[model samples]
Target chain A: MIRVVAGFFIVMVMISAATVYSLKETTQQLKAHKQQLSADILKDRAAIKVLRAEMAYLSQPARLEKLSRRFLALSPARADQMAKSVTSIAGRENFKQVAFPVDEFPLLLPQEKPVFRKKTVIRQPRVRKAGFYDRISLKLEKNE
Target chain B: MRSADLHIEGAKSGALEVARTRLIVPVSLFVFGFSLLLVRLVSIGLFEDISDRVTRRASAKTEIIRERVDILDRNGVVMATNLPAPSLAVRPSLITDPQEVADRIVRLLPDLNRTRVLNKLTSSRHFLYIKRNLTPTQVWKINALGYPGLVLEQAEKRVYPQGRLASHVLGYVDMDNKPQAGVEKFFDDHLSNPERSNDPLYLSIDVRLQYIMREELERAMDKFSARAAAGIIMNVNSGEILAMTSLPDFDGNGAIDPLAPEMKNRNILEPYEMGSGFKTFTVAMALDSGSVKLTDEFDATKPLKVGRRTIHDDHAKKRFLNVPEIYTFSSNIGASLVIRQVGIEVQKDYLERFGLFDKPVIELTGLSRPILPTHWGEIQSMTVSYGHGIAVTPLNMVTAIASVINGGRLIPATLIRKNKGENITSSNDYPQVISPATSRKMRQLMRLAVEKGTGSFARVEGYRVGGKTGTAEKVVNGVYDRTRKITSFVGAFPMDRPQYIVFALFDEPHGTADTFNMATGGWVAAPVVGQVIRRIGPLLGVKPVMDVKTEYQNLILAGNEKK
Candidate 1:
């Protein structure tokens, strides 16, 4: 009976030791996984910072100005090309029609010629020069 | 049989007693230790709390140590940033072959002297830096060498992504992460403190406007072969400096040339006489004090003698001039006469009220004081009226102009970006420098000056540009040098409701064909202001209303003012 009790005690201790070992192993694995995830997040944050800086550098005004000079033949948008409101135009019928910038005083002189497409209106924003003056145009269909 | 059984039982009981004595203490201690171990395991394994605690502690220790806040423009563009740049260092004790390591390092980094690296490798010191600010490519190359001694330790580098665009304003940072000049120096503490460094610092500058103004100044500098140029664009209502630049500026990333002196911002640091630019203040003072009216006339038949120095207009309008004519023609005699009508006491008070006496309080450091006259006499006042005797920085002049044009409230110029929800309107309790009526009149006169007078070149086709031109001969050894002129123009656009102030000045600009051998303010500076207004107007959301003539028909005095 003493021999049997000793055997049972040895088996119970062995089982508990094995459970503890497996538990410790899982904890270590989980710790390692968390560390790796944290490292990835840190790396991603660094990449985002670098990309933001790169975007700003690429969009610098000097570079854009140079590219504009090389590619586009258009000059700086003069004051005459802009109007205070839509009514400043000749008529409602000509609103959708292409508004050509006259050589001088486009607002004062009668429409000499159409310089743009009838489907789109060319308007330069008065604030912030993001500087993509290209063939890309947004199609806006006015509700009748 | 009973006696034999009794003998066995007695033996068994004796044996049991011996066993109990031998094992009881040892078994109890073993059970206690095992129970403690199991409890600890359960706490760690099931709860999983200790790991989180360790992570929080580790992150707190490593990540929250120190960091520098980024500097941004008004539109949230990153102008300056701090990035972790790991640098190569070596443990001399661990280096097996100094010569071999030095040779490889030299091959990878040609700029790093082989001799220096060899010396560092052979030095008695345990650790020494091989190179700083190593690019990722360089780091990769160095790491590939696989020397046990060579290690990369993380360090930070401050970068200005905009390069020379706002070099003077952003200034430069030292290797120690200390800001040496500009906004960096201005808000050093706020940016460097670990507690407050997370939020980015926003400046009032608009990088787009800054680029436009700087380009225009560069063109003027190259075209006229000028020594230097300074320009500024300010929001008249908010006192926000949208753009400011000094020519010969250096890139913030590189070593600044000491000989060039281009890094020195002339706008805020150097004070000039500001010449006829002061005439605007004089005329405005007269109008504000109710000493002069729009129809009031002054005789500008000859140069007025003040003490030994005679104040003369270069292009003298030799006739009786009204208040508008005095400003339009930029008549020094007329300005001096207006000062007399307004009296010297009121002139000093007005100038003092304009914050011309004190140093300009701005975000940037190294601001110079306005050179006030030692003796406030009649001659000083007269010369100061036409902007010669008293000297003030271009920033102060522009700030004062903004106050005059922006509804008569003297708002101190700011470099920090104001939030959208922040109150931008001037306080009712803020002291009124000039009446709203006087402000309107001043705006009209400025427009008329651009229209009919010396500032005609600044007149855009549709935009009603209002401003004054100042051409002051640089003083050489206490005497005015006729050859070298500092010509400047300070103007605001759409004078009916002025929104922005543009000031352009060039130092010692030579005569060009376009300027007709006259390196005057109207010739050089006025055209720069016009170019800037034309290009930047659309970008700033300012719509140029057509019919400038009929709109300001009463204000337009001359026909050539028409575009």
Candidate 2:
């Protein structure tokens, strides 16, 4: 009886010790994870700030205006450019009115139909006799 | 023999009692202690809740360390924000090799002075700063050097990505996180509060419109060779400043001298006599007081004399002119005559009602006070009527003009953007400065002026523009200098129902070849307003109706009624 009781008490103490040890280990892991997540959040926030500043800098009105003027044919929309209604625009002489189809999704029609042009073919150079270095250069050019 | 037998029996019983006592006490104590331990273990393992506590511990260190809030335009474009930066400092005493460290740092940051860095590194001082607000890559390179004396501290930098786009409006933040000027200085406490710093402040300014206004004003300034120029566009109904610009502006990110010419915000902080721009107020007050009708004729045939001061028209009609004709012609003599009928007391009351007697209230600091005459008499009244004796900022003029054209209710100008569904009219905050009928008539007078009078150059195609022109000889050395003049144009669009007010001013502009060597308001400033309206009208979503004559039929009909 004495041996049996002593064994039971020792088992209970070991079980409690194990529970405490596992809890402490888990708490430490969680704390480290929490720190890592915090560091990641800070990094992400800093990156976002940089991206926002870059976007604003790139989209500055003066810079955009200069770029648009240089590259694009588009300009600020004028008051007269806008139509009061679709019917008003359709009433124009150049406008081609098309009916909407019931069975398919709607598609916007371009004001003017796109024209198809024949593709031009390039003429090849005549082959000539080459030296050793010239042949190697030609091969290198072909690889590039 | 019986007594000895009793004593031996008693001794045996006592020994047995002692053994029983010892065994029972120890057994009970061990059993009680074991039961307590078991109960505690069960409670902890099965019943006690710790997930909430664990989560609290996990997230406690992740709380955001808030800095100053950002400033955004009406469209949620970030005008100003904070970026995390690394600052490099070194302990002079701990640096083992100052020469090597300085050389490495100079190579990392080319902008730093090598000699200065060496001096600081070799100094006897305990600590010294090498540089601040270093880029992450630079900080990394410096850290890789692994110098014991080099220390990196976390810091934040205020950045303005728009540069000089709205410099005067956004202002700039100092290195110490101090608010310096404009809205920054105005909303310091609110922006710095940690709890509210996450939320950005939205200003009423539209950066696109601001860019357009500044571009056109700068173009005009270049063309006319003006000393300075200022322009403002406001929602006439809500009194929100959509765009305001003052030329020779400094960049918000660069260091600025506080007293430099470029640092002056010409739109609000500088007061000008405003010349005939005040005539709009005169005519509005005249009609509102019922003392002078639109058809009432005033004699502009000759110069009028009041208190030894003669008032002459810059462009004399030399005939009896009605109120609308007088306004269209910008007749100073006629404006004085109209104000004469309205009386000085009534004029003063109207001026006070228009908020011209005080500095215009806005969400900005360093507002210029209106320069009023010390003595209020006949000459002061007449000169003030034609915008001479009294001086007010262009902001004040815009606000008062907005009230006159926007159905006569005086809505205070605000730089802070209003929230969606915010009821501006329900609060009864804006007081009626004039009758609605008078405001409509004033709108017509302005339209007629733009259509036929000195403001003809301000007319834009399809956008029915109405405005008045002012060309005032600037007061120099206590005398009116004819060589120097301040020309301005104040107008509103869509004459039938005006929605926006535009004001353009130029200081001492020299006449260009295109202007016929004339630097008057109609020749210089009016065209600037016209071009601005032409470009911004579409952006502002103001629809253009082709038939402008029909819209002005009411004005024509009203004029013919008394003719």
Candidate 3:
């Protein structure tokens, strides 16, 4: 029994020692990972700064204005060209209503349509009211 | 029996001696184990957190490679930022051979002098800097050489990408990472501190509006042959300066001169008489104080004599002009007469209340104070009523005008962008500068001026442009130079409810053939306002109705009844 208790204590010490070693290794790995992520973030931040400066330089209004005039044949919109809404131009009964505003907005919204859904695109010939469909229809009619 | 007892006592003594010897080994072992634990505790106490040590080392490197915050426009356009610029330095003691190292480095960096690099590498000093602000490719080439003595110390360089576009506002920094002027100098504490440098400084300036304003002002200056021109477009209610430009601006990316004409941020720094634009404040103060009524007429038939000087009316009507007529014609005689009835003390008091008597507090450096008269008198009041004898900065004038036309609340002008999802009007801490009724009346009078009076040149189609015109003689050596004029026009659009205010002023503008040899505000400045409003009104999302006349008929009809 004395020898058995001594062996149990020795096993306990070895287990505790292993747990400590594992914990230290995990902490070191975590620390190294955090450092790597931090370094990547710093590098990305520097690259973004350079890119931002480039973007501002490219999108400057003076240059864009010149480019638009040369390439797009667009000019600053006139006040009279603007309206409050689509309904201002036409009534609800008119078929030729103002659908969308025709301005040079770079970002156009997606269309929202409420039309009836077409069930099938494939065209099929009439089945002459025969066979299983004809019998099912007759039974349903009698029941009704 | 005695012999047997002696033998048992001897055995007991021997067993006791054996137990004492065993006790010493266990006690000494415990002491050794505890001592080992104590050393471990001391080492851990010394090291503390490993992350902290790494951070400290990183910071030591970053001190040389400083990180300065970027200044961005409201739309995240980077106006100013830092680029990683590697600077080359050397340890002379570590260099085994100086000449070979210098030759190899000089080959890679042709800009560096071979002699200087050799001398630095061979110097007795432990450390010496060789070259600075190297491109990434040059640094990579030098790194490939694998020289132990030569080290490329990394640092950051501040760069203004917009060049001369927003130079006066962005400011510049020195090689030592010191801020010299503009927003850089003003917000240095926030930039240099490590704990709070992550976020970019967002300004209220919109790049598009700024570009347009600058283009228009430059065009006007070129056309009129003016010495200089300045313009501002501001959101009245929020006190956000959408665009502000001063002509002859310098490139921020180039070499700077603090004393150059291009460096002067005239809108906020310089004070001028502002000519007839001052009349708006006089009329507004009179209406707000209940000293003058909109229907009351002032006899502008003759110049009003005060003490030794006479207040002359530009484009004299020589008739009894109503309040609106005085504003429409920009009558100095009429303005002075109204101030006479309004009293001189009240006029000074009103100007003080409008924040015109002191230096305007804003987020920029070198803001000069307004030039106030040493003594206040009847003549001073009369001249000041017509925009003389008292000089104030254009920014102060715009601030006061914004309050008068923007529901009568005074909000500070700020370059910093307001917080997202935050409403400036929700803050009840702002003081009411004028009554809403007074602001409404001022808007109506300004519209009447633009529609039918001397400001007729300021009419933009499909938008109700309300404004007043001022053409002041440039003061040279404490005397008015008759040949030189500073023509200025201040206007608000959609006068029924004003959203923005535009101010354009040209200094020392010469009369061109197009203007028929007239350098007055009516001829020079009014057309610029009209053109700017017409171009930007639609872009600003202000719907242009064909029936602007009918919609603002109430404001205009009220004035017509008095006429």
Candidate 4:
């Protein structure tokens, strides 16, 4: 009877020790998890700030107006133009090619020409006949 | 011998009874004390656990954690909010080599100065800041360095996605995380807490209308080379501000130097002598007093001299002018003559009733009171009749105009959304300030001004717009400067029922080639109001009326002969 009572008390002590240890481990884990969640919340808040700044920068009126004119082919409404025609053609045409100059012409390079051989032979023969008559007259004059 | 044996046995039994009796009392006392302690422990620890839980929860600071509030447009577009961000910090004492850590950090954060980072890391302080607000990828790269003592602290910052679109209305927060202007400043206390029961402030501002007004006003301001400009669009019935804008405004995240003087909010804070816009009030006072009828005519042929001051009409009638002609031609002489007939006492009462004598009560922080003439003599009343002797903020003028057109209901301007189930029309709360008949007559006179008078530029194609143009010479050192003018225009659209009141003002607008080099309110400010109405009309759910003559035929005809 004495041994049985002693064994029951010892078993109760061991069980109590284990429960306390487990509870302590769980409490530590929970604290760490809470800290991590807090860090994550902070990170998210900072990201929101960055995205807001980027949105503001991109949504600026001057930038949007430029983008609309470039991509959507939008133009300011002219006071004289009728509304129906303006709306129809405003974003339909490709403005890139429309702005190109259509009146410009390409420059041409100069070319060389060939000479005729028949004309050259006739000039040589006439020069030889005139030289012989001139030489004979010059010899008679020198002798005189 | 048998009797002696019996006597000895009895004596032994008696001794045993005595021993048992002594043990009984002490044992019973010990058992009773142990049981009492056990019962007390169980009662305190288990039975009252809920009360203990309540106590612990009350003492905890779990609710104090900073949480961001949502800022939404009238259409529920998210304008401002908070998101998480990782920042780099370090436990300096635990770092093995400060130089190595700094070099690695510089490689990851190229914007960081290597020398400065090294110095911070080498400090003996337990915690040192290496960089702030790092991107996730940058933080990941820094973490991969496997360096000890590195810490990443998390923080929240304000964000404005619409940028400068509504900068003035959605004022920016300072580095200390305090809202500084516009709605942000006006609703800071409610936005800063999560546990508070106050609902989020819902403004009457429509972002789309705001954008349209900003775009059109910017274009006009640029075209006119105006020094500064401000505009407002108010619901004439509810007195809700649909859109309000002032130029030279900074983006929410844009750097604002504290020393710069240009950061002032011109719409609510700046006071100007709002020239001829006051004519509406003066005329209203005269008509309301029964001193002058619509048919009553006054001589406006020449400048009227009162005491030492002379009030001249910009467009001289040089003949008898009736009520419609006084407003249509913007005759200063005629307005003065009408006010003189109304007398000083009546004029003062009307101006005070219009809420012009006090500082405008608005939700925003900055507000300026109108500078009224000190001495209330005939000259002061006459000049004020033409909007020269008094100066008021744009907001004050807009609200007063709204009151006149909304059938005389003086609704206090508010930024917070009205609670449901609350009766909005309870006389105990909101009382009618003006009669519907007076409102209708004022609408007719305003329409006449726009149709044939100085506010011709305010006329929209389909909308029956009515307005008054005011071009007052800015007073410098108590003397009116002829060259510097504060040109302003205030108008209400669909004059038959009068829904929206739009007011635009330009300070010291320089003459532009398109304006025929005229910087007067009729030439510069009226066009802006017209454009604002044209762009914002559809956004505010006000459909354009193609046939204006059919809508307000009776009232238009009653005031038609002068036009």
Candidate 5:
């Protein structure tokens, strides 16, 4: 009975020791991973800071103006480029159309006579039913 | 047979006792050892709190420490930030060959002196810094050299990526991590607070408008060959300074002498006799008092003598001018007469109410107080009417003029971004300077001035810009110097409902060929304000109201045109 009790105590201790050692190993690994993630976050933050500074330096108005002058055909917008409302712009466009009516263009000049030309019509090709041998011959010709 | 049985039983009992004693010894030892182990494990899991300690250490290692918070524009653009800069230091005792190491370092950094570096490396000191704030490439090269004695210390260095853009506003941080000037000096505590260092401080400045105003002012300065120039653009209703610039400004990232003349923020720090820009206030004062009407006439037929001084209009109409004509023609005699009618007490009260009596409230260092005359007498009031005797900073002038045009409310000027709920109508800090009706009339008169008078050069076709021109002889050694003049213009647009106020001043501007050798405010300063409005109007999203009938036009139609 003493031997049996001693054997049970040794088995229990071994199992608990194993569990504690494995738990300790996993905890250490997790701790190391957490540290690595934090370090990565810090590195990323610094990188983002550097990138922001670079972006601000690149997007300065004077530099942008110089770049635009060199490469773009755009100019500062003017008041005339903007309209109060869509209807107002549409009205302006309609007024521009009315300002130069197509019918009035000739009447305003009335100096040149109109030229006349004969009308030409386009012809459509006719379709015809084909035999199986004809279709086979056409396919053979396409293959060739 | 009974005797033999007793003897065997006794022997059996003795063996049993011996076996039991041996088992109890081993069993007690095992129980004591196992209980100790179990107690240790329980204590470690429950009482010791190992995980708590680990998490605390992890958090401490990851916490980022910053030297200072970033400064940003209203649009969230980084105006100033801190960048990681690795510094180089060395232990002299650990170095075997100082000359070779110094030579290699000098080769890597061309700007460093060879002899100085060698001396530092060979010095008796235990440790010394070779350089601070090394570039990334330099750090990489030093790391490649693999010197265990050479250590790279991690540090943060403040950098302004925008360079000279808004330099005066952002100020600079020194190597000692001290806030030197401008917004940096004003909010040093808040910026250095470790708890809030992660958040950035935002100003009311718009970089685009700031750039536009600075570019135009620099161009104007070069064109007119002025000694100095300053410009300001403020939101009229909220009193937010959108852009403020003083020319000959230094780069925020470069070395700066804080005592240099260019370091002065002329917009708020220097006071000048703002000439006829004050006439807007004079006219506003006259109309708001209910003592003088817009149609009331002031005699500008001749020079008016008050005590030993004689006041005359630069552009003399030589006639009895009405209030609109007085403002339109910019007649000094007419403005004096109007102020005289309003009396000195009323004038003083109105000027004080306009905040000209005190320094302007803004987030900047070294704001100047308006220079008032020692004695409040008739002659002083007469000269002050046309902005002669009293000297005020451009910031004060702009704020006061903003009040006049923004429907008679005196909103204090600010550089910080006011919250959405904070505005002129919602805030009780702003005082009513003039009646809304009088404010409207003043707007009409200003419109008339820009439309057909001295401020005609400031007129932008579709924007309806209205303003006043000021040309004052700068005082030299207690005497007015005719050759030295300060010309300025203060205006707002779209005069029907003014939103932004633009002010430009040129100190001692020489006459250009295009200006017909005329260095007056109308020639030099009005066009600057006009050009600024033409450029920044669209950027501010102010829609150009075309063909809108203004009060000035109606007055003109009624045959009440003053000019």
Candidate 6:
């Protein structure tokens, strides 16, 4: 009986030691994950600053005016041309039919209706919660 | 023999018991020590791990390094930025042979003095700087030499890619990490402080508009053989300075070569007797004080003499002239008579109200105070009425004229950008300097000037430009030099609803055949202002008013009918 009691005590100490080792490993993994997230946040902040600057550069009035003149063949609206539609409102009905405002006539003209066709069915990706060691293994597999 | 045997057995047993006791004591002590060591190892491995992690994180996050902030234009165009560079340093204590390393370095960097490098390397300090701002290729070449005690440190150096395009506005930074001039000096604190995460300072300048003005001004400077030229375009409503160029400017990245004394910034720093531009102010003062109406007439047929000095118009109109005619003809005699009718005290008070007597307190440095008369007497007031015997910067004159045209509220000129769609009403805290009616009359009279007077060259079709021209002879050695003149033009565009005010001035402009050999304001400066307006108008979102009637025609017709 005394021999059995000694053997049981040794087994209990060994189990407790293994539990402590696993707990320490988990804590280290948590720290590394937190550090990676923080790094990602910093990178995202830098990218956002760059994107905003690029957007501002692209939206500059002088550049937009140049692009419009080149690509769209648009020019600054003449004052008399802007007043022509309004003056037509005070004129006869035949005049209105003959010279309808370009801005307002877009709605009156027949337009092609866009057909909404679904290509691939939308679905959410499957999310799996893996342990630290399993995540390492999965990452290795992806690398391979 | 039996008794002796029995005594030996007893002694042997006693020896065995003593040995057993000694062995037990040492074994117990060993067990205790092993357990204590195990406990200590467990404590360190598990409990102390959190604190160790925190220390590692703290050290990792502590980047106590200085980095330079970027300088951008209003539209976020990079004007000045700090690029990462390598600089050579030396660990003096480790340098066993200083002369050997210096000889090798001098070959790679010929600009460095061999003796100076040797002395710095042989110094007693742990570290010493040999040279700063080395290119990547130079750094690699020097490091490949494999000299002992040599080190390379990462550094940042400023670069301006636009070269001399916006030099005066986006000033240069020095080696000591200090801004020297222009917007660089104006917003130095904002640029230096890293903790300021507020949006980067935005200027009201447009780079394209700045390019146009600088290009045109350069052409005029070359064409007219002028000593120096300065131009400014301001949004009359918001007091935003769109473009300001002072020629003979240096590149922000290049070494500042010496400049001539007269080629300084004549817009804000050098005050000049802005000849006839002061007529607008005189007319505004007379109209605001109710001393003279737009219909009031003055005798400008001959030169008017006051206190042994005669004030003459460049183009003599020997007839009774209305207020519009006086401004259109740029009649100094008529303007002097108008000031006399308003009296000296009122004229002085009006000038002070227009911010002409004080230094221009804007975002820029190097502002010079206006040279006002020491004592306000009849002769002083009369000559000052037509912009003589007093000197003020072109910026001051433009701001004053902007206030006169933009509904008579004096808004201080600002380089700071305003938010889009925000209300930009003039500052109402100050008293109204002139009534709306007087402001309208002044605009009409200025329009008349551009239509049929000295400012005729300033006209742009369908833009309705209005302005006054000034050609003041530079006072040399206390006597006005008739040949050396400072010609300038101050004008506003789309006069029916005035939007922008443009002013251009040429210092000591010589006569050229293209100008009909006449280096007057109307011939030289007015055309530059007109070109600046035409180029910058589209960039500033100011469209030409094609349908609006020309107000100049009606004003001229009214004046002619009265005659």
All models: lDDT?
Answer: 0.82, 0.83, 0.80, 0.74, 0.84, 0.77
Give the alpha carbon lDDT tens digit for every residue of B1-563 in model 4. 65325433565887866666667755885697579679968986775445634544343433344755657665444567655566789998889988888888888888888888988888878897776667779878877998878998766667766767677777778865688777888888788877542244556676667787788778888887777888888876666777888987777765776445546677788888998899898888777778888778788767788888788878875777778778777888988999989999988877788888888767788788889899999888888898987899998899888878877766766554443333234434544555667777889889878887799999887677899999999888978899899999998988888888888999888888877889998899898889887766544545455555432333424544553
Root mean square deviation (Cα) for candidate 6: 10.3
Q: What is the interface RMSD of each candidate, in Å?
A: 8.8, 8.6, 4.9, 15.3, 13.8, 9.1
TM-score of chain A of each: 0.41, 0.54, 0.59, 0.47, 0.54, 0.49
lDDT of 6 by residue, B1-563 (tens): 65325433565888866676667755875687589679969987885556755655654452343545666566656556666567889998887777888888899999999889888988888898888889879988988988768898877676665556567777778876688777778888888887753346667776666777777888999998888888888887777887778887777766664364432566788898999999999999999999998778899878888889988889886777888888898889999999999999899898988899988757877789999878888988989999999999988998899889988977678777666553268456444678878888788878878878999998876577889999999999989999999999998987877889999899889888777789999999899888777665655555466555544455556766765
Give the DockQ (C-alpha) for candidate 1.
0.22
Question: How far off is residue B90 in model 6, in Å?
Answer: 1.8
- TM-scores for candidates 1 onward, in order: 0.80, 0.80, 0.78, 0.71, 0.82, 0.76
Per-residue C-alpha lDDT of model 1 across residues A39-139, encoded as one tens digit per residue: 55665655666766776788788997888999999777677777766667667545653684332211121222323566667677557543221111111
Which segments of model 4 are wrong by more than 4 Å?
A: A1-144, B1-65, B99-119, B122-124, B128-131, B196-199, B418-428, B550-563
Which residue pairs come into collision in candidate 1?
A: A126-B538, A126-B539, A126-B540, A126-B541, A127-B539, A127-B540, A127-B541
For candidate 6, the docking band is incorrect
Q: Is candidate 4 or candidate 5 better by TM-score?
A: 5
Output the better candidate (1/6) by DockQ. Answer: 1
The model with the greater TM-score, 3 or 4, is 3
lDDT of 4: 0.74
Per-residue alpha-carbon lDDT of candidate 1 for residues B254-345, written as tens digits (9 for 90 to 100): 76664468878999988888888899999999998989887787887788786787778777766677778788888899999999999999
- Candidate 3 lDDT tens digits, A1-144: 985897688668767876676567566645665666676566666566677677778777788878998899777888777766655655644446646554332422223322466888857865664544345445656999
Per-residue CA lDDT of model 4 for A11-125, tens digit only, reads 6765786567655755554555456566555445434545444554465446777799889965643322323232245676543433532222121211222233664434434
Candidate 1 Cα lDDT to native:
0.82
**How many clashes does the backbone of model 6 have?**
1
The digit string of per-residue lDDT tens for model 3 on B1-563 reads 54324433565888876677667765886797689679968986895466765764474333334588888887778788888788899999999988899999999989789998899999999888898888889899989999899888878888887777787777788876789888889999887765655788888887777787888889989999998888888887678887778888988766677788888888888887789988998899888989998778888778888788877887887878778778877889989989988998888888887888878757888887899889888888888888887777878888888888887887777778776454358436667877888989888788878887778888988888888888899788989999999888998887877888888989888888988989988888899888888878887788775655522334335644654
Residue B261 Cα positional deviation in candidate 4, in Å, after optimal superposition: 3.5
Q: In what order do the candidates fall by lDDT, top score first?
A: 5, 2, 1, 3, 6, 4
